[model samples]
Target: MIAAAWLFGVGGAILVGIGGFFRLARPALLPEDLRYLRRTPDEIDAAVPSLRGWLRLVFIVLGGYAVATGTLTIYLAATDIRNAESSAVAVLAVTGASSIGVMALVNFALHSTFRWPLSAAAALWIVATLMAVVS
Candidate 1:
């Protein structure tokens, strides 16, 4: 069960980290045809300039940190299978659920960043994994 939690969280973190790196690498990959949140390449280029050199490096660094932390947490969870059914799991579940809600908010309000929705769903998966671990 704890292994499942770690899998979900770590997988999500890796995917998100990759997504962030992709944004930094090729911001052009972002969707530009959504009606609700119509974004264009021009807008992206204007907003982020695609290649910001040092800024890109910074984003990559931060994203790497997030990935590392998430992976470590997952590892810890896996090692805690004996006592997985604890309050910590419950807290993670709640956090994951809220993260989903926050992702929804970001999607609707920001209307950009395709990764937000994926992250939201991933959060739910992590929460579900936590529940399984607790059980």
Candidate 2:
């Protein structure tokens, strides 16, 4: 159970960290499947600056929050796996569920492509939360 929790927690952390990094430092890293990135090269180049510039601060803030939460889950799980504290499990579950909800909302609102990774991470975190609780 501890091993499973650790694996899921670390996997979630890595995914969230990578997402946060891309959002903060490399908006151009947006997946090609994203609706906003489906334009021609010239159009994409012309639009990337304005679009990314406009959302830069927002992305940075949200990304930072996501990274922080993900890191917190990893740290907490690593430090106290034996007890499987309820508070820690609650936080992990809440954050995981919140991430899924927020990502779904964002995808609906902006018609973006952030759902896939968010869904994946959310699933892992949810499983980790369950494992922690059971253990």
Q: Cα deviation of 95 in candidate 1 (Å)? A: 5.8
lDDT of 2 by residue, 1-135 (tens): 677568656755764675578565756435543555557656755766566556676677777777776677677677655466677677667766676546655665665566676556566666777777777
Best by lDDT: 2
Poorest 10 consecutive residues by lDDT, candidate 1: 26-35
TM-scores of all candidate predictions against the true structure:
0.52, 0.66
Who wins the TM-score comparison? 2
RMSD of each: 5.0, 4.1
lDDT of each prediction vs. the true structure? 0.54, 0.64
lDDT per residue for candidate 1 within 47-97, as digits (tens), equals 767444654666677666545545644554555533665655655555444
What is the Cα-based lDDT of residue 26 in candidate 2?
52
